[model samples]
Target: MITELKNIKKSFGSTDVLKGIDLTIEDGEFVAIVGPSGCGKTTLLKILAGFERPTSGELLMDDALMNRVPPEQRNISLVFQSFALWPHMKVKEQVAFPLKHHRFVSEAFKKQPDVRVEEMLSAMSMSHLADRYPHELSGGQKQRVAIARALSPAPALILMDEPLSSLDAKLRIELRYEIQKIHRQFKKAIVYVTHDQGEALAMADKIVVMNAGKIEQIGTPQEIYYYPETPFVADFVGKANLLEGTWDNDQFSPALSPNVSWHFPKVSTSFKQAGLCPLRPEQLKPTADNQHGIEVEIQNVQFQGREMIYTALANETQLTIVSDADTRIQIGERLLVGT
Candidate 1:
């Protein structure tokens, strides 16, 4: 493991934020720490980056104790949600800030590895913007420059705290691909922090889902999305229609009045009894490819051009569906919805 936290705990005044955060992150793996606001995602990141000292427990990087190590001495880089670039400095100066801070120049530093200030800009496609000031650049451009600066030294690990949150939706999507490209290019371990589930799902090799300072679930995007291990994970990870149900024979009978139930092909790993059974919008459809289906009333049909989102009401339970079926929906019309 590149980074390991054993029984990690932290508190501020009276509120205990991180509670026994035991995690093992692999080398060169892209990991994301995600949760709602005030969930200590940033606090955990700070602790790992050696910015904040944990009140108790131990942190190890490759089995070396890190609780005593200083921030820069830890040799890890952090990229924040806000592009914390200097307004006065040029792009090259910003990229070279860390190197200049310590004044650690050597023959090997001059000859370096694959990473350089120019190469970092080239990698992020921000070479032209290198001469431009921060105010002159677009939000996406500034974010790219920030990422370029972070990756300039090729640190062993990089911490990203919602680095794409400042960008527009289109730019966020575009930069996500670029970040992945850079991750592959560097093959460095990453500890990313974000609240946006879509961003976490898109970028993370493995996701560490947090809730109220505790880790709810940790898995790949597919595992976290399709096989949510907790109620929080099921609800928070994505848009899920929670159907209150009871399990029987690898199936669930939802507590809806019209004797509603679903026979899932497989059981969830953490299928708590009489709890919420999550179904994504795509799962509940007007027509099922198989025998299992639910009867519902078409509540609303939103014309989204490509794949339309259909809303249906079934036994007082509202269901949303993303489908491409050529079905004109009236408010009170009945429809069979299942999958």
Candidate 2:
């Protein structure tokens, strides 16, 4: 299912939640929408799932308009963050419910719901606990059952709204891989909504970064991380430090380091116009070469297992740099930072 939204706008009386959203989801593509709270990502997902109507714009599925269609009429499955499973229904029955009641269920699934339910539960590794109720299962197992139920009917598109947010960090990682495997095996288009940048980077084929009810940028993970078009995207997605600079065509001279000039041709015009350069923490390194680097004073250090995070100050401007764990740099020490 190729889903497209054109000039979609949503308003709640005086407040505008979605200010003209334009996006497309290709067939079998995994797209993740990431942004901070109240960025309208969840509202957008609701619009796609037919739970909310757009104030003005076209919602198209395979070139057919579906703005007025109800949630049950749309050939889509939604997996919620809260795991909306019935307490009385067992795992197998939960999986079987969709196959029996969904409007888009396959003939084979409807003909033999028990077999389909068993197959779905087996795929999710919940076959052994098929008789357990939601309250009897662990959090991970309950979410797995929810996923199995969503996938049982074989919908054309799957919409997930922070399905892993309620789990622990380790369990979240486990479910991310599971979701990826399911997407690959089912070949269904998935529109995932989350605020975690790492989740979008790790799982999404295409990433949409939204801010203040508007899309800041849309690209692949590498493109969004390496070549951010806006300052918000740079800071939000990659934790980039935006330095004050003067741009002379492709060359940029930092205000703090006047002698150092970097040639960046791919930087967007907005950054150049603002006389700023965005550099990620990993892009800058400490060096002793004063002539080619900016001088900074190390203020603090945090030691992780494999790397060290340093907070440094250059001309009163704070900066963050990731360095090797073995490098011996003390607090209040002056160091030259260069790309």
Candidate 3:
């Protein structure tokens, strides 16, 4: 199923939450909406799920206008951050609820909801907790049951709003893989909303970065990480060092450190004359020989498990470098830093 959102705008009491969002989700694509709190990622997802109507613009599902469609009639399932499981219902009962409510069961299985429930639970590795209540299950198990329920109706699309936010780090990682597995198994279009950039980078086929109710950039993870179109996206989507500078003669000279200049491999005359130059931490490296490198003083060193993060100062400019942990570097030492 293809879903297109054209010039979507939403406002409440003069506060605009979504500003002219135009996005499309192809069949079985995993798209992630990522941004900081109040950036309107969730608001955009609600528009697609039919929970909230846009103030203007169109929502089309496979060429059919869906702006006025109710959430229940949208053929979409939403998995919220809070699990939203029935406290009194057992695991199997919770999974079967949607099937019974929507009459999704076939004629052969109309009388046996347990058959479908068991199949879903087993697929999610939650069959052992079938008879357990929400209170009796772990956080991860409850989330799995919630997913099972959302998939029970076999909806054409799935919307997940930070579904793994409540779990611990390890459980969150584990469930992320499970969610991807389920998405592949169901072959349904998914729009996942999260504030975590790592989650979006690790799971999504396409990542949409939003800032202040506007879409800053939308692309594959590699493009978003390495070729961000805007300053907001470059800084928000990954660890980037933004150097404000003026472009002149195929070189970018940092305004703060006028003596430091970086040569652009391919300078485009049409590019902005004054803008921020983005460099990832991993892009900078240490050089013992200062012949042609930017001289910088090591301010601090942090030894991570697999790599070392060195904070250095180039005149007044602070730079972060990720290097091998085995590299011998000390605080107060002077070294040449380069790309």
Candidate 4:
């Protein structure tokens, strides 16, 4: 393991921000911490960067205790959400700042400091803006410079606290790909904190879903989306329609409409009682010829480019469904819903 946070806890006066967060990051692994606002994800990232000390538990980096280590001596780089760049420094100077502070000398000392700065800026496609100050650069350009500075130090670990959240939609997508490319080139362990689930699903090798102050689940993107361990995770990670029902005889019967039930051939016998059955929006299909399916009325329809979102009502239960845009369905129409 490259870094391990063992039972870490943090509190501010009477408010508990992090409640015993335990996570591990391997060498060159990209791990994303995702949750809603005020969930302590940023606080966890700060703790890793040594900006905030934990209330209890241990922080181990390569088997060395880092509880008392300062942010400067931790050998970790942080890229903030706001892109903290000095206003007076040019792009070249900003990228070379960390290298100069750490007294980095190139192998054989053959290249000048400006030469190294050019290489970094070139990698981020910012070489053309070398002499530009922060005020002269766009939001995306500033973000690129911030990333270049963070990577110039050659740190073992990098902590990014929602670095792409401040950019526009198009710029966010562009910078996200750039960050992923940089990670592949540098092979540094990265811990990224973000509230956007789509970003986490697209980029993270392992995802950590947190709620309130504790971790709800940690797994690969496929596992987190398909087999959520909790109802909150099922609803938060993706669009899932949770049906409150009773399980018996290898079938789930919704409590609101006991006459309608879904057959599950693989359900365990222990859970043959009351529980929630989570079904993805894409899993629910509307059929016109299935007589055994539940009858529902289409309440609303929305066109979403590639797919159509439908809201339906069945025995007072509202359910959402996603189907191909070519699907022939309309509002105020009665249809059969099946799995």
How well does each candidate superpose onto the true structure, as a TM-score? 0.91, 0.98, 0.92, 0.92
Error of 4 at 94 (Å): 0.5
Error of 2 at 286 (Å): 1.4
lDDT, residue 186, model 2: 84
Q: Candidate 1, overall lDDT? A: 0.82
For residues 145-169, write the lDDT of model 4, one tens digit per residue. Answer: 9999888877889899899998999
Which residue pairs of candidate 3 clash?
none
lDDT of 3: 0.85
Candidate 1 regions with alpha-carbon error over 4 angstroms: 102-107, 111-115, 257-261, 288-291, 325-328
lDDT of 2 by residue, 1-339 (tens): 899999999999999999999999999999999999999999999999999999999999999999999999999998999999999998898999988789989898888899988888888889999999999998999999999999999998999999999999999999999999988988999999998899999999999999988999999999999899999999999699899989999898999988898778889898999999999898888777776689999999999978889999998899999878898689999979888
TM-score computed on alpha carbons, candidate 3: 0.92
Highest TM-score: give the candidate number: 2
Better of 1 and 4 by lDDT: 4
